[model samples]
Target: MKKKIFLVSTAAALFLVACGINSGISSEQIGLRKASLENENKVVLADINYSAAQPGEASVYDRSYENAPPLIPHSTEDLLPITKDNNSCLSCHDKAIATDVGATPIPPTHYYDFRHNKSMGDVISDTRFNCTQCHVPQSDAKPIVGNTFKADFTNKDLLKKSNLIDVINEGVK
Candidate 1:
């Protein structure tokens, strides 16, 4: 009897793993909601302090295309990515649906034609398969570790005052 019970439990575990339809992050990581810790992390719903109260325009996770990547606001482990024929972003971004979900939908950028792609002969997955590759959520929460980033913008005047421009004008004097 114990052997049968273990077999059934193992099968169920395999099935869930095969299905990517789960929150990609843990509750403790995102800081809200409830979940079980058995093979997954958990959080108490009461622990939630803030929420996406009202849905607005579809969010663009990566604010600066040249800088950091965006993070997901909600769970996306369960979401299916876009492929050659399917773009699932429209599923939630249509104002009719996104407003109800309390999260923004995909922005018009998704509609833009990205020249980036893989050659069919190369057998690569469509470049869009990994949404996280480009877009990322900006979290207000504290950093997971000490930040190393220092401001280069703040030092702009340092160069302007150095008379360094005149030196360069001499061309290696």
Candidate 2:
């Protein structure tokens, strides 16, 4: 038993030593850019410039992708801290009032309780009540690192060929 343990320990040590501590590769060879915060004494934070609420034709903003959370096209200056008794968003976004206010009503899915397997009547389900969890107001702040991401359906021809609603509801009965 002692000989088996000794041989196992020796083999493990030899394997680790053979792998060596360093690959001897420079940072530049792997194309690693310097971190944005490396030179900053204080933590570098982006200066968020909140966009003002735009009415009428100016209110529209293209969604990042089909079924992606639509960016809040208007300002959320003093309209936050959504509470049990006081949700400021419901004043305009509630299904009953949205059409009158010319605001988009919260989707039917928001009222559907997936866990309960039933449609919640009139009110936004508890799970979906906090709108900010999935939605964010757009800001004119530049990212510390550049984004190179491209949406899969950016091409107009490709987008036209696919029915987004059908794709989104593919598995639902």
Best by lDDT: 2
For candidate 2, lDDT tens digit of each residue in 64-114? 665677778787868888888888888888989888978877777777787
Please give the TM-score that candidate 1 achieves against the real structure.
Answer: 0.30
> Per-prediction TM-score, please?
0.30, 0.65
Q: What is the C-alpha lDDT of each candidate?
A: 0.46, 0.71
Q: Residue 149 of model 1: what lDDT?
A: 56
Q: Clash totals for all models, in order?
A: 7, 0
Candidate 2 has its poorest 10 consecutive residues by lDDT at 29-38
Error of 2 at 31 (Å): 16
RMSD of each: 17.0, 5.9
Model 1 is weakest, by summed lDDT over 10 consecutive residues, at 159-168
Per-residue lDDT for 124 in model 1?
Answer: 28
